[model samples]
Every structure is written in structure tokens, then in C-alpha cells.
Target: MSNKLSIVVVEPDRERAILIVDSLRAAGDFDVSVISEVTGLARHVSSRDPDVVLVDLTSPSRDILEELTLASGPLDRPVAMFVDRSDDSLTKAAIEAGVSAYVVDGLRADRIKPIMDAAIARFHMFHRMRLELETTKRALEERKVIDRAKGLLMKARGLDEEAAYALLRKTAMDQGRKVVDVAEALVTAAGLLS
Candidate 1:
């Protein structure tokens, strides 16, 4: 019921972590927690279930990047990573790990709000794209199954495609199920009999 954004800041340095927390508080009314240790980062972040995560690192290693990837939770939430310096490989790795906003030497108190906003926006965009892709894939699979069922009906009952589809749709309406479900069942049964 609370509208406050819950944020987790991962920083190994105590002083820097405090600074980041203060910056977030100054930016807005945010509920923030800081995790100073890199060990078991995934567990810590998962336990918090934050709306967003901010990871500030002086230099990130492959192991740390891997930990960050796991901590991001399959892109469940937005993650902003600020690094003092980074190379092409590190930047690529961070992006691949689902860090929505990857900043190189741009971690300032003044920039926190905008960076956070961008990260959240990017996360939403990617999430929407992912959902659309899944829906498209599912629909394509359903179409294939329905076509196979129609093929079976046309061959077995000597009916045209239109008639076969009409039978499938009528059965689906009578059974109060989706056309895809009925088609899938028919396909499964045909496979079994064969």
C-alpha cells in the first residue's frame, strides 16, 4: 500500500555507501538499505525485495559482475551500476547482466534522481518487450497446433479446411474451452492413436 520506492545500495566502502544513501534520501522520500559486503549479495538483495538496486563499485571483477547478475533476479527490477572506470568487456558484461543504467564515472548526488529514473524507465521498456515476445511466441505455437489439428480433421473426416476449423470452434464453444485447448487435445489424442 506504500508508494515509497524501496532501494538497495550495494557498495563495499562504508563511507561511500553512506554517501549514496544520503544522496538517495536527498533525491526523494525513498526507503533505502545499503549492503557493504559482496558475499552472498544475491541472498541479501532477494531478502530485501527492493524496487530498484544501485551498485557502486570502484573496480568490478568478473565474479562481482556474476554476483550482480544473480542479484538482479532475472531482470525483476531495475539496477543501476556506477563504476569509476570500465572497459568494453566490463560494460558489455554489465549490460548483459541486466543493469539498466550503467554509468561510468557519473555517480554524483545531483545525478542520482535522473539516473534512477532512466534505469526504471529502461527496465519497464525491456520488461514490456519481453512480455510481448513471449505472447507472440505462445500465439505462434498455438497457431501451429491448431493447424495440425485441422490437418488431422481434414484427412480423417474428408472435410475442407474451413469445415475442419468450424468443427473445432464449435466443439470448443460447446466444451467452454479455448479453440487452442481443444486443438491441442485433438493433436495429442491423434498422436497417441498413431
Candidate 2:
């Protein structure tokens, strides 16, 4: 389990996703979770915290590419792009969109298997340091979330820090989640209701 690699695959095509999954599983000890859209990708990424993300596409769309790029942080992992976009402008956009490894046309998965494996291995090598960075980022984001939740709770229920935290902790314990998770949930809920 400790030696296993987790990867999030954002490929819209189910068959291609399976091919990548099978190849990766055959090549290394990888736990692959495949998804189609960017929505909820961050949650999967933040929770699963995969070592790398393999995003396969025939071309680069401004919105989707940008979303995938922004996902790198919460994922705290490098992105491997298996693209068919051969246009120079789009290629440039991909690089600026946070693609760590961008492979253009004429590069199929089999031909690039070794490179992908190496990239994934390198990602794991830096996983610890990346985890530290993500921990710091998460802590900072948690502070902001908790503060917002606390403010809402205080305004709505007149509670102090200790009481607000106690509520959050109890909610987390009951739900078998982290206090930060509860805080985030609360904040999200507040945002929706307000």
C-alpha cells in the first residue's frame, strides 16, 4: 500500500481511459481513478491527492485547459498532457496553462510509456516535499475557511471561537471527517444559502 501510486485521470473517453489505466497498472502499482469533467476534480484531487494527473485530449480548449492547470496546486502534482493539439499557439497556451509535460501529435501512449513512468516516479520522489507545501497551503486555506465559518456561526448563533470549534469538531467526529472538512462544508453551505 505504501508503495502504491494514485493517479487521477481526466479523460472523457471511457475506452481510452481504460487503456491508460491498464497500461499504468501493468507498468506500476497504480490506483487510477478516472473522471470526465473538471467539476469535482479538485475534491477528488484534494482528497485522493494523487501523485500525478494524466489529462488526455485531442485539442486544448481555453476553459478546460485553464481549469486543469489551476488544479495542479490542490493536487500538488505535476500534470502530464497527452494531446493531439499541434498548433503552436495552443501549445504555448498549454505551457502557460500549467502543463508540466506536454506531448503533442504523433506521440501515442505506448511510445511514451517509459517517459510517463519516469515522470510519475519523479513525482513520487518529490511527493514528500510537495506534501509539505500542500500542507502549508491547506492550513492557510483552512484558516480562511474556519474564520468565515466562525463569523457566520457568531453572527447567526452568537458563539465564540471555542464554541465554534467545538461544534466543528463534534460535527467532524460524528461524520468521521476532519474539522477542516466540516469547516469547508459549512462554508460551502453558507455560500449556497446566503
Reference-based lDDT, each prediction:
0.65, 0.60
The regions of model 2 sitting more than 4 angstroms off are 1-128
Give me the runs in candidate 1 sitting further than 4 Å from their true place. 1-111
Per-residue lDDT of model 1, residues 65-182, tens digit only? 4444333446444333543334454445445544433322333434444446444444345456778999999999999999999999999999999999999999999999999999
Q: RMSD to native for every prediction? A: 15.2, 17.8
Clashing residue pair totals per candidate (backbone < 3 A): 0, 0
Record all residue pairs in model 1 with backbone atoms less than 3 Å apart, i.e. clashing.
Answer: none
Question: Model 2 — which ten-residue stretch has the worst lDDT?
Answer: 97-106
Tens digits of per-residue lDDT, candidate 2, 1-194, equal 56455567666667655766676677766677777665665455545655555653333532354344443455244343544444455444434443333333334455445536544443343445657999999899988988888788888898987898888889899999988888888889988998
Model 2 CA lDDT for position 169:
83
TM-score of each: 0.49, 0.35
Residue 11 of candidate 1: its Cα lDDT?
67
